[model samples]
Target chain A: QQPVQSPQAVILREGEDAVINCSSSKALYSVHWYRQKHGEAPVFLMILLKGGEQKGHDKISASFNEKKQQSSLYLTASQLSYSGTYFCGTEPGDYKLSFGAGTTVTVRA
Target chain B: NAGVTQTPKFRILKIGQSMTLQCAQDMNHNYMYWYRQDPGMGLKLIYYSVGAGITDKGEVPNGYNVSRSTTEDFPLRLELAAPSQTSVYFCASRGTGGSGEYYEQYFGPGTRLTVT
Candidate 1:
């Protein structure tokens, strides 16, 4: 089944912070995060494996909780370029990925 | 490496018409997938291939077929298209490894198909 993402949409100002959460009904072997700007393909951000690892890049970071079957993306000091739709794809230890409906984030100056 | 490429960026089809959406990756990835996204919705997998000659069905594979004749190509075919099949199709490929937990995928520009 498709994972559930909270906060269908959010608006933020530059340098602000925001969080997007994804929860799955089934156990997830991994969680992949991506960002897609308007009219563009989704861009890979980071992937959290089963160990409940956390990863970060620039002002963006993500954490996976195996016990809860959930993952969270943390955007700190968000930038205007961060305005886009965020997608979380879950893999149930298989070759296929099931993506969430997505969360739209708009960052303004 | 042109990463992944898909043909016929946009298409319009009538009910019962048949067509194939082509996807190719120059990265020599071992896995390829086809997914469709409806308006304001996430992607749903239609088909996937683990390697050349090994194809499998995903969450939403009905009315679709796939072929992996080579490592660089995986195409999705639709027969007797219906209005419900109208959506933006995406083709993605990822290399092997990563403890099989997470494999970063590279997606093509996507094909916008409209079935009437």
Candidate 2:
């Protein structure tokens, strides 16, 4: 099943912060976050495996809540380059990864 | 590294026509996947391969076929194109065996197909 993303779209200014949430109806083995700029392929951001783990990149961090079957991505002090569509892919089993509807984010100067 | 590469970035097809979307990866990953994205919808898996000559059906496998002849290639075949099949297709690959950890997947630019 496809996961659901909250805040379908959001606009933020530089130095501001935002969060994107993903929820799945089924239990997830892992959650992967990716960002895709207009007319470009999706780029990997971070992944949170089961066991309630958290991972972070420079200013981006993600946490997976196994019990809730959900994950949240945090962007601190957003930059213009952060503008893109963010997708959270969920893995229910061992082999397949299914993506969410996606959240569109626009960071302005 | 080229990561993953897909051919024919864009194509327009007439009804009843057939075509194949080619996906290749240089990372030598053991797992490969094919997905289709429709407007306002999340990507749906079409097919996947765990290794050479090992293929399996995914969520949305009907109207599509796939083959894994080698570790580097997994191709998706559309036997008879239909308007419903118009969407962007992406190919991805990931490494295997990380203690149930999620390995980052490398995705291709994607192929945009429009069936008229």
lDDT of 2 by residue, B1-116 (tens): 99999998999999999999999999989999998988766778899999999999999999999999999999999988999999999999998766655578899999999999
Candidate 2's residue-wise lDDT over A3-95, tens digit each?
Answer: 999989999999999999999999888899999887778899988888888988999999999999999999999999999999999987676
Each candidate's DockQ score against the native complex? 0.88, 0.82
- Against the hidden reference, what TM-scores do the models get? 0.96, 0.96
- Tens digits of lDDT, candidate 1, B1-116: 78999998999999999999999999989999999988888888899999999999998999999999999999999999999999999999998865544569999999999998
Best by DockQ: 1
- What do the candidate models score in CA lDDT, each in turn? 0.93, 0.91
- Best lDDT among the predictions, by candidate number: 1
Per-model TM-score (chain A alone): 0.98, 0.97
RMSD of 1: 1.2
**Candidate 1 clash pair list:** none
